[model samples]
Target: MRAIAYFKQNDIHFSSDLPEPRIGADDEVLIDVSWCGVCGTDLHEYLDGPIFMPKDGETNPLSGKQLPQPLGHEFSGVVAEVGPKVTKVKVGDHVVVEASLGCLDTHRWPKTRLSCTQDKPCGACRKGFTNCCEHNGFTGLGVVGGAFAEKVVAGERHCIKVSPDLPLDVAALVEPLSVSWHALRSAGFQKGMTACILGAGPIGLTTIAALKGAGAKKIVVSELAQIRRDFAQSIGAEVFDPTAHGTNAAEVLKKMSGDDDGFDFAFDCSGVKATFDMGLAFTTFHGVCVNVAIWGHKPVDYYPMLVTCKEKILTGSIGYTTLDFESVVNALQNGDIPLDDCKKLISGKYTLEDGWEKGFMQLMHHKDKCIKILLTPNNHGELKSAK
Candidate 1:
């Protein structure tokens, strides 16, 4: 099998001899990948990592699987086979994988080194919050080999079938879109409510679409990059260049709100001190602010009065749950989310062999020029139109 995988820190490449993944349990599924999108986390791993990936010579605590594994958590594919107990979907079904692996999945790897016991799982998982599991990890990140190859296997619980009419390329986006959707859901977003997103990166752009689908009456995006602002506008966000506003930018953002007071919800996807403070500073008195970005280890300055005096809800959201995947799929199916807009997110496509240089490095160097770049196994015929 051919694959683009990560070995140790700063080492990821293509190989033709990577072993094919097999169904390890009776409820596992075998997927023939159609397309896989490289994520910022993938780039982070290549630059400075082993973050989610197990250390060299060490296996993942959840899967007990060693490194040098395939790297792709955002993917869509067709079901090629199903285990004896797999009842979610059968052969030939078009599907997207949920990709999350947590304490609840320890049953699939009885030999794993995690502390999950037969009767007790993580505290978060016990309360139905697998996304916040104590030992949470993702399939492609290190839990197991993922969809960046000819075929990958997962448990039936992680597979969600999509409409045959949905394009496979857009389907691969469900994973990332679900991340934003979950954040919105956590914020208690409602139709006709307004939102202010503090960034225009991949997650920020998807947050725009998620807000629109939830029936937002007005959405504003603040970004410093011209190209990213353009991308946000292409999908219906009212763009703002904070760099132009100087220190008075936060005041200007509040004036643009529907009430001219502040936004009903603000999401800090930029994860910087300035944006983080601005998110709280400009939100309406009782509005919510959700931190959705993967921030660094250093702590940022915070004023207790910013959130305390206003009685605003300050929270954060991580990975998506299975329900998020199902809801996003339904939204795309019912046209609440335009498939054409999803297609616009795709900036390029390449076969798996060339993915590292063309797809990964393209994101590494020329990130502003791209939104999402897809890679394929060439098993499907999308390569004929590859750019």
Candidate 2:
């Protein structure tokens, strides 16, 4: 199997000898890769990482898997094979993977060191918050070889079957969209609410589509990049550039909520000090502010009074669960989220053989001009028509 693999930090590349995955458990599923998306986290691993991929010599805590694994998590594919107990999907079904691995997943890898040394489910998982598991990991990051390869084996529980009517390329976007959907759900976002999303990057753009599907009354995307702002606008969001308003930017954006108070919800998709401050400052009394972005080790100064003064709620959302994937897929299929708008995020497509140079490298060097770039193994005959 050929795949873009992570050997160590800064050593990721395309390899033709990566071992092909197979269904190892009764609930396992083998998928023939159709399309996979290059994610920001993948770039982070190639640059400053070992963040999610285990360190140079360390193994993943949950799966006990080491580095040199394939690098991709956001993906869609056709089922190739399934374990006897895998009833959720069958061969030929098109699906998108949920991708998270946690304490609950230890049973699937019964021979793992953790399974033998520490088998208890994490407190978060016991409480039904598997996303916050103490040893949370993802399939592509380290739990197993990922979708960057020609084939991937995911647990049936992690695979969400989608309508065959949905293009596999568009189905690949569901993983990122599920992240935002989980964030909004965590924040208690409601239909007809005015929301402000900070940033228009890949995750930010998906946040807009999630909001659209969830029925936001007014979506205001604040971004510094003109092109990203335009991308948000094209997805039916009202775009805002805070640089023009100086210190009063938050107040100005609040007025756009139409309440003259503040946005009912504020999402910080760009994990920067500016957006952090703006998310807290621009939300209404009793409003919710959700942090969906992954921040670096550096900490930002916090003022409890900001939220205390107005009774505003501040929370953070991490990875998604199966529910988010199911919801996003249903939204895309039911006409709540326009397929064309979802397709708009795809700026480029490349074969897996050239994905490292043409897909990942393109985003690394010229990211501002790109939104989402997808890679394919070219296994599906539909590629001729799908392309």
* Candidate 2 wrong stretches, greater than 4 Å: 115-119, 379-387
Residue 260, model 1: Cα distance from true site in angstroms:
2.3
Give the range where candidate 2 is weakest over 10 consecutive residues by summed lDDT. Answer: 378-387
User: How does model 2 fare in lDDT?
Assistant: 0.88
Tens-digit lDDT track for model 2 on 1-387?
899889987899898998888777789999998899999999988888888888888887777677789989999999999999988999999999999988777767754666422256768888778898777889899879888989999988889999999999999999999999999988788999989999999988899999999999999999999988988999899999989998889889988999978889988999999999999988989989899988878999989999999999989999999999999999999989899998888887788887888888888998998888888887553332111
In candidate 1, what are the lDDT values of residues 122-160, reduced to their tens digit? 788888888998888998999999878989998898899
TM-score result, candidate 1: 0.97
TM-score for each of the candidates: 0.97, 0.96
Best by lDDT: 1
Best by TM-score: 1
